[model samples]
Target: MANEIAGLVVIVTGASAGIGRATAVSLAKLGANVVVTGRRAERLTALVDDLADFPGRRLVVPGDIQDEQLAQELVNRAVAEFGRLDVLVNNAGLGHHSALAEMPLADVRTILDTNVIGLLAVTQTAVAHMKAQGSGQIINVSSIVGQRPFPHNGIYSASKTAVNFITRTLRMELRPYNITVSLVYPGLTATEFGQAKLGQSGGNRFGLQGIPAQRVGDAIVKAVRYGRTEVYVTLFDWLFTHINRLFPQSIDWILTRRS
Candidate 1:
């Protein structure tokens, strides 16, 4: 795995904190030159500082993933600086905790813009580069909620659902180019995601305590090495996904009881 990752140029978005940040550091530790992007300049700078002694190089591109120009710049800069891109991690995303009836239309659009549209913009740009390279990997950060939407998480769930479809479709489309598409569906993780969703961070909405963000980061590395199409950050998330598939009504009953 180290041999496969070493010398590869990888791009990670939403890298200011949490899973994105952890993934960037993890890959850098394994000798992958990493380009890290997000909306927080100070945090990104701090991340670069943290990686000062990493085996591979790190580049900080602080900006919103929703910016198309930024997306293009990420790919261009990765190629120009690192020579070529070998991997792209579409981890930049946000979610709001609201039901369709009460959620503002603007918030819905915002979630879709960041989680779905922004992911696509970067992916489209990366695909162009990766296709030309003939061998590349695209790892999309989705969520377990994508497969099973719980109450009060309609908008966020919908966006992740879209991510699932996008990843699945691209996996086949990019196969000919030797480009692998993988999806990481995380359950609740210790990140600012909860704060972004519910306007606060400490609360655990899933009943289960969130796992460390590094867990997802490690999963990303494994997925890339093995060419895995789908991964769940925790075993529980994987089990739940399967349970939902095998017994939709039973899972629905459990969700209703919990909700």
Candidate 2:
């Protein structure tokens, strides 16, 4: 079969670094027009420059994802530039590490604003256009923590859990419009995410090294091509989710010990 990714227009939020950046690169290499957005103008420009040799066009729209206005403008620019939008990668998000009781209220708001509210904003905007076109795909970047919340990272996990629900609902609501929504659960990713977290860094409490962001990015590309409802970076990630579902109390006991 011909490459489905080639000639599609994709918008990736948080494309300045880590999984978002890697995903943009992966899609561009496969001949997809990519619109990358993030808070850092320089980083987004660099991303576009790095992909100069790729066949697909690149557009950079640098702004904070939390701004509702930015969400509108981002999608507007993508549609205006590319003429159509085939995919939206809601990869932009914030991370928090402090305990629920100890975390500052400001920190909690920040996390929710980006991970949940901001993601919804972009999704809504993209859906409007996608509905007009009668087809599109939405790939939400969630985390394994969403299913099994770690002690210190409960807040972040909660935000991702919300994403899980939102993605599921969108999948059903947008079905008539022919828009598919998928979720990507990345187990610990080796990125600047920890260092940039809002509170004390948990610093790999899982006792295992993180997988590369590129691995997660590749899984996202696969999700788009295959229309997989749930994408995991590894077999272990898939098993972990299913196992947690089967033995919730047992997993809770294990997590308590880790804490």
Candidate 3:
């Protein structure tokens, strides 16, 4: 699985920071030609510099994932520069934290636009190229909240839930083309995600510490190499997801009490 990454061309969205940045670094180090995109050009450029010592080539195409043109350009530039696209990591997403009653409709639209619409736009563009080539991988970065939503995080959870279903459907639909679709459910990653959330400021009030963003990045890399259907960043994340599935009522009760 480790050697499988060398020379493969991979595109990572939200590559300016956090898990996306870490994933790009990991892929570059393993000798994968990486194309990184995000809204921040400076940060993306900094990421390219950080990977300067790695074996594979790197290209930065910074833009908002919500832009359909950017999505097309991302795939176009990758194929143009690297000649082939092997992996697409849909890690670009927006987080929101507000009670359903208090959440603004505008904010809801923004979250869905970036997390769901943007994801699909980029994926649809990549799928066309992958289908032509007959081989590729798609890794969508979801959150544990998608499996079990916490208080004040319903909107964000809903977006990831859509991603979960989309990934599963893609897996079946693209099987004939040998395009693998994988879902990554990462629990409370220690990144700017919480601080950068759309509403509310206190950050994870549950008193639980978050794992490093690099951990999720490594999981993404592993999923690409091994063709995993689903990847969880930690044992606890896997347990929580399954436990919620088996005992939804109990989990709901616990969460209600915690909130």
Off by over 4 Å in 3: 1-3
Please give the CA lDDT of all the candidate structures: 0.87, 0.92, 0.92
Q: Which tens-of-lDDT digit does each residue in 1-259 have in candidate 3?
A: 4438999999999998899999999999999999999999999999999999999999999898877899889999999999999999999988998898999999999999899999999999999999999999999999998888888889999999999999999999999999999999999888888777898876466888889999999999999989887898899999989989999999888888877
Which ranges of candidate 2 are over 4 A from the true structure? 1-3
Error of 2 at 238 (Å): 1.2
List RMSD in Å for every model shown: 1.8, 1.2, 1.1
Give lDDT tens digits, candidate 1, residues 44-100: 899989888978888887778767798888889889998889999999988776556
Q: State how far residue 242 of model 2 sits from its true place (Å).
A: 1.3
Q: Rank the candidates by TM-score, best first.
A: 3, 2, 1
Error of 2 at 220 (Å): 0.5
lDDT of 1 at 217: 96
Off by over 4 Å in 1: 1-3, 198-206
Better of 1 and 2 by lDDT: 2
